[model samples]
Target chain A: MNPLDKPYAQLALAVLAVLVLPLFLKSGILATEILIFAMVVAACNLLLGYTGLLSFGQGIFFGIGTYAAGICLTRWQIPVPVVLASAAVLGAATATLVGWLSIRRQGVYFVMLTLAFSQLFYFVAYTFSGVTGGDNGLLGVPRPSVGGTALNAPWSYYTYVAVCFVAVFAILVMVTQSTFGRTLLAIRENEGRAAAIGFPTKLFKLEAFAISGAVTAFGGALHAMLIGVAPLSNIEYHTSELILIMTIIGGSSSLFGSVLGAGFYLLLADALSTVWPRWLLLLGLVLVTVALFLQRGLWGLVERGYDLVFRRERAPETPAEEH
Target chain B: MTDIALQTRGLGVKYGNFHALAEVDLQIRRNSVHSIIGPNGACKTTLFHALTGRVRASSGRIELDGRDITDTSDDDRVRLGIARSFQVTSLFPNLALRENLRLAAQGRTPWQALAPWRRAEANAEALAIADEVIERLALAPVSNRLAGELSHGQQRRLEVGMAMAARPRVILLDEPTSGMGIDDIEAMKQLIRDLGRDHTVLFIEHNMGIVMNISDMVTVMRLGRKLVEGPPAQVRDDPEVQRAYLGNMITGDIA
Candidate 1:
């Protein structure tokens, strides 16, 4: 059965879960972090999982959105929705430029090209400390007000981020279930065969890159408003590495996997850092185990478990999520 | 001869200092199964590559039904009613057999591919074509199975089925019966013979028995040059073909 049969109902339940999550934790901070980063991981999933293009420069697009939102809100006094829209546009434009130059190459070269382009973005932002505030970051970016009321409370901001998160998530799920997405899967399987069948694979890859960049930037914009700073750390290589790790951990090509991955990594890091100074060592070991044992990531494990318990004949991998 | 479906004039390919194919001229008549048989180094595959625009000819003019398409891209060649199967089986292994054929069929009509809603509307034309091909190739039982999981013979049939999915005026088959047993070879030979009734079929084959049996016309190549071209019987009787194939070592069994 097609798993995407009732996306609206699934989304409503998801939103409901987020609404009650803060009650159990007593702090909405981690929940908010999960929501924002889930969007980022989903964007990464678009390129890496679906299109089969591993871009290490996704952080640059997110950083661009964060910086753009910060500049608009702090200096120009732009409203919330407009700033977010501008950030998305800026991210898409950068991704288009980078994708055009990088898509010509494949495999390791593709990864290196994106990495180099991101470094270029990082240095550019670093050099313009006057505008970017460099190491100090663009601090005190305001949480948006909805129709004259400031979203100062944690729950209020969580509601705002959750709404944005759900909308983008639904859009992504639709895309993955689309014909264009199938073509991307075809390209991922055999690019030569895809082209021989009359698909312009490069053009498809570019479209994927643009869409992924826009969503990631939108997530970054929301993140900046939530944390009250457009920090340099958002653009750094380390952030890119973390996002890539989350994508793999959740499972490549699975959208729900993206959310599961981002939340798992973020929560683990948050909880572990309090107990140990070198918490990453444990995280690294966990990642190794996941990579070695569960190549499909946590999502594949979930599917395997579902198959075993239900005793349903395992079918070919479909784009839709089970949950 | 009937009207020329495909013609190449002085087609040549150079790799640095070596000549992969040189000074080759040929004609593939409409609605005829033409087999290009040669040794491994005779550049039969290179000639196919040039025809499909997989590799640019260093010097040549390729005409498809009276229009020059020497500079066309591979995918454009497919659009212009030309399709080819690889020497090695090329398929989307993870996808179902039906989906592989559907992908090929859908390539002809790409307008609906971007519209996700339209994609689910059941592309009747593509589905019909895929269904017909699956039945014709006897892949009905395994239609839902992944292409990679199929037996080698089934995979070979699917590869050719994918080429036919394009509804090409001219279909290129590179060793369709390679590595098949006697039974599979006979089946493939019958399929090619049937295919010749409607489509301009061109193939490269190492097996002289199948080529000599099924092909209406044959071209023999030696070291990137056309050594002989004529009817299957006429080419089979040529002394040059015998000497070229290690003095009757290649053609002795078939003739």
Candidate 2:
């Protein structure tokens, strides 16, 4: 099934409207959290599923983004827009440099280099005692404010985060639907074939990775603005793992699946950890079950189910018969 | 009358200690069906690779039309109207047959060096070319079939369709009818003959009957060097050709 053909634009607007309704319900805090996490997972999806290159270091960009904003707000007294934009650009440039080196290898080597780079970023952020506050992290990251209005209330802050998610998501979708998107899809199908047929497969992969890194950092910056904190925990490999699992459980190939997975998995983990405190075992168990049974994740599974239920609904006709 | 499509001067290629294509020189005429015929490992494929810029020559210059492109990459050669079909089926298995053809056609549209594909009138024209190829190749019925799902002969046809969709002036085919059945072989022969009207075709074929019946000229290679070149009838009757093919049976009227 052509997953990209799904009505993402219309559905994105619909989801945005539904999320805004939470502002009225006063559940905007949870809704904003869901939207932010969705964008992070969606950023990871840009490289992982679309370009077919998996990195274990996506959290570096996310953490860096958050820290960029967090440090700027607390120390530099930078505005939220500049902070977010600068963080994203910085992350993108960092990603480009990493890509220039890491892209020379493929498969396990690619994973290893990205992981190494992520760890390097983590240590840099961790050891900076004066600026990053070291283990304590920077505090008093002022709430993100627009031109005149300070988004101090949960409802107002959530609205801002929600709007950011919608815009980033729409752009990502445009990228996926454009000529760049089709070329990446070709690269994903078979890198060697794509190269043989005049496509610069390696260059495409690197550019895509850089784009993913930048987007992830943007999401991270926004998250820092929302929570008013940027701690060492945000950039760890475990954070990267969490986003990967979110992509897996919600259907990695589908953009919406990433969001759904982020919501379901994170919200579930958040609740379970508060109650049981050792929900890692349960989380691991759930991941194992999903991998074993429903490999495509919930959305893909639902999509397959839809196809099966509607068998009479215009089967894709084979052109071979016409020949 | 002195039109030259290709000219190779001392074209030599070495793989480690082995000389795959020794110092060889040849001129292929423009608008002619030139066939390269030889036994296994006679450097026929190597010559084709050299022509298409897939392999580097050890120390030689290769001129296409009138320009030197010895150091040009395969992709650049493709843009310069030298398109090729691999000896084996090279169509993308994941994509539909038409999509594969579309990709081939889309390569014709030039764009900024690092930019992704641009939507030129070329894209629509590419689709139109794909439709024409599908119809001409008798692939219209199987045009929507996944390339992997096609029968071996159909896949071979699709491979040719992919190369043809480029609208190249020069088409390099390596055994286009290698594994086809008699009926499919005939169809392929007919298609190649039809292509000869508009393209400068250079193919490698072991099937002597197909070569003599279709090729205007034949270049025979042996032991990594060009042994002879002439009209098919003349080359077929050469004593050296008979000795090369039949070993010691160069007897009587056969030679």
Candidate 3:
């Protein structure tokens, strides 16, 4: 069967996979880590794949979310739900500022603008040691409590994180299936025609950026809760590059590919680091192979395999290289 | 005898030291087929851009039904009942034919974005319009095909269908039949005739046969200025039109 022809069936399969993953994994913590990054990768897919924009500054919003959650828990002693909501708002606000200024240009100029702004935010976080904790980073963040009991146990926290992941994923799925989402796809395919047909494309693009930033930031907040520490590295350019690589390796436009990509990248890194000090060299080689041979990433390979097994006529490959 | 559908006075556009269009005065009447004809580099496309607000006019006033709309933005111009098709067949190439038509039909209602669950009536309206355009353009057989995968003639027809899907009162089509087979040209001419029954059609055409057969009024441009404007028969016999298009096939049938 053609997987793209049956989106609902594909979605059900993905949900089932996510539900049963924690039962088979050796460490729930690693699974939780993969889930969190999967949310960020899904956010990237909305902008990069559906909207045809390549933003290199997603880490800034992610960092802001982490810092917001850490400060609220440590300084004010606020409840966990409130902290997450506030972090999301902060991320959306930051995205509005950056997207408004950066979207004035197109192509490589737009990429450079996002990179420059992200670097600027990184230095600001680095310089303000008293507020952000500088190189030491913020420490001693609290685990959330429901009613009177704290979810201090690993599996208990994993369940809570998993719930958050499912909620975010559901919302993103709804968004991508809506009329607004179709408009974004139209813009991605042809901006000039979208405008000629009476769409305020610039406004649509900005709102998309804001939504992407907010979701990624929410994922970052959940991550801080899982680790109890908001490190300086989370905001660095390396994290931004890592997130981009994961999104591409999974598949650009497919939401399910986000989870698969994050799991593949993180699990491979964790497994290889134990044996080899230069593990990234191997990852780099794999990435090159995927880029050249499988333009749609790992998901594209899976679809091809499905077609090979079940059908004789192959579907035309999606033109993912244009972006 | 018909009210003026669109009028431009002293319309001019310049690029640094070069003048692309200079002091053009044009008027298109309601419910008529008007075609602009000129040799290459005569600024027919540039004038179209100024009319659609795609390019800023150095000096001009564009009036749509007696309203000054030179200051209107591109998208706002579309919303105000003016739609355009590009010369290069601009379309959502990766999307299906129906999806492209639907996007053009629903571009004005951005408020639908506020909620996930769309209004049934709005979606129904867009779909109905898209379906109608598809049947009219005879694209039902390949409605599920990606626009990029279609042949040049089919893509050109889809481009026109996209503009019509928006339900505009006036259409500015840039070379709608630029590169089409003879059968496609006849089909396009019939479609334009049908559209002229209710809406104003302002098109740029190089085909002398189609222009002479279909246009109610014709404007010929040369060197960024209007050479002549009259009925097609009057224009084909104008002495100045012959002088401007000398050694060009556009004037070959003038005598």
Candidate 4:
């Protein structure tokens, strides 16, 4: 077995990334954004990688969390913990509704339903200009206070988000190792057989959606605080696409792959956008290359590197067995 | 509570004018090996589907231990102690053989199956059930291997083992030995005989030899209807059973 397939190894890699990012990058904001997105992409993996669901409506939950933080922090001055919890609750509720409706169909229809729901949510956020702050979004979203002082410095906020990131990552890892996670794999491998084995397959799928949405929204809340604005783009179709791209690019096979994916995209964007304004054209090329060669994404490359260094024979191909 | 472990009365399935199965009645006794044997297009599989609630019955009453369960969903049917294997080998291919059986064993308790906070391996009961099934199916040697990586014969055994893992009161095997060599067939026959000792075993088989030797009762289906059903000796001696297989090549095996 690959040593990296263990949950501890994955968690170790996550911690290493969090600790190592600040040393290499000058921008604390960029480092913090990567961590937030890493969590979001990992949540997406819970659906795509484990449960065999490709949800385009993830941004709906993320945006909901962003707005939850934006509205509560700006107007009501709710405690940070309460706001975060509310975001998760709202995200889970929305996901349950969407999952219940979408899972009635399978395959392409299911994918289409999620995509349509994404559009539906985007328009609702757009139409309710008062609550969503229209195009301007809710601005001046203050950072959480730590010991009677606001985390005004980017690095200080990074420290706060890092702690949350580790906690969330550890929880996600634990969840993926659980019986519920195993059943999601079973459902992904064969839904019909899973049902025959006596699982209420639809309910399980909905539960997965709920967990994914909750985690994604929590990340969304963190993202809002990092940027200091609940931007309209957070709930847009493009945000959904971006999260999915990171998930695929990192490889859906492992949770740490989500980190690699988010980090790779952000780092590449950071490096290239200054050199060329249309860096997205270059990103498109990279995506195509990933699709053609690295079907398992950057994590697959990492696994190959480990295999080569250790001189171990490559194990037989299996779906992601670890978080 | 009753001699009948599973029962169906006036069971019929239709696809807009074509009757896949029609007016079929079955009373599978408790702890007996009942084999359904028939030619292709005889709807042997359809009957299994109806009993297991995979396919909706057009007209019928399905009873489990004398309780009506006609409208029960497939998963609920399994929860009611009815488990079935497919005519085709169906398993969680990416999962280990142990995991495949564990999922089946865990299916009996869905609340535990959805407990995300705890490790799946911590469920000692499910693991024990999987290990027991692996031992029974003689798959212990490769229990850690992925289901997709196993040989065809091994996968077939795993298929049956998955159903047994559910610990169901009524177990349905749809063409359990569809493709098997002599030794594997003999092994499967023995396994089914042993299974019948404790669980009600309903199987659809093309192998007449296994049916004749192992089955307590034989049910012959022809063109979506029951032609004959009785003890193996009685079924083999029936003229109607002989006539139904007269033009078919399987008639030679029946003789």
| Best model per TM-score | 4
- State the lDDT of candidate 2 residue by residue for B1-255, as single tens digits: 348887889999988989999878878778788888878889888888788766888878988888899998776777778877878777778778888887777666533223433432336777898889988998877777788889998988988887798888788888999898889998988888888889988888877767888888988888898888898779878888886564533222312
TM-score of chain A of each: 0.92, 0.92, 0.94, 0.96
Show where candidate 1 strays beyond 4 Å: A1-20, A312-323, B111-122, B249-255
lDDT of 4: 0.91
Which of the numbered candidates is closest to the native, going by highest DockQ?
4
Report per-candidate DockQ.
0.42, 0.34, 0.51, 0.62
Which structure is stronger by lDDT: 1 or 4?
A: 4
Task: State the lDDT of candidate 4 residue by residue for A1-323, as single tens digits.
Answer: 56786899999999999999999999999999999999999999999999999999899999999999999999999999999999999999999999999999998999899999999999999999999997999999999998999998999999999999999999899989999999999999999999999999999999999999998899999899999999999999889999999999999989999999999999999999999999999999999999999999999999989988986665855643210
- Candidate 1 lDDT, tens digit per residue, B1-255? 349999999999987899999989988999999999887799888898899888999997899998999999887888888888888999999988998998898877655676543443367888899999999988888888889888888899999998999999999999998878788888888899998987999999988888888888999888999989998888878887776573654552343
lDDT of candidate 3 over B1-255, digit per residue (tens): 339999999999998999999989999999899999888899999998888888888998999989899899888888788888889889898898898988888865655653444532358888899999989998887888789988888899999998899898898888999899999998998898899997999999888877888899999899899988999989887877776573355542432
Report the TM-score of candidate 1, chain B only.
0.94
- Model 3 clash pairs are none
Give the count of colliding residue pairs in each prediction.
Answer: 0, 4, 0, 1
lDDT scores of the candidates, listed in order: 0.85, 0.78, 0.85, 0.91
Off by over 4 Å in 4: A313-323, B246-255
DockQ of 4: 0.62
Model 3 lDDT, full chain set: 0.85
What does candidate 4's lDDT look like per residue over B18-96, in tens digits?
9999889999999999999888889999898889888999997999999999999999988899998898999999999
Task: Candidate 1: give the clashing pairs.
Answer: none
What lDDT score is found at residue B67 in candidate 2?
87
DockQ-better candidate, 1 vs 3: 3
The superposed Cα distance between candidate 3 and the true structure at residue A87, in angstroms, equals: 1.0
Range of the 10 consecutive residues with the lowest summed lDDT in candidate 3 chain B? B246-255
lDDT of 1 at A76: 87
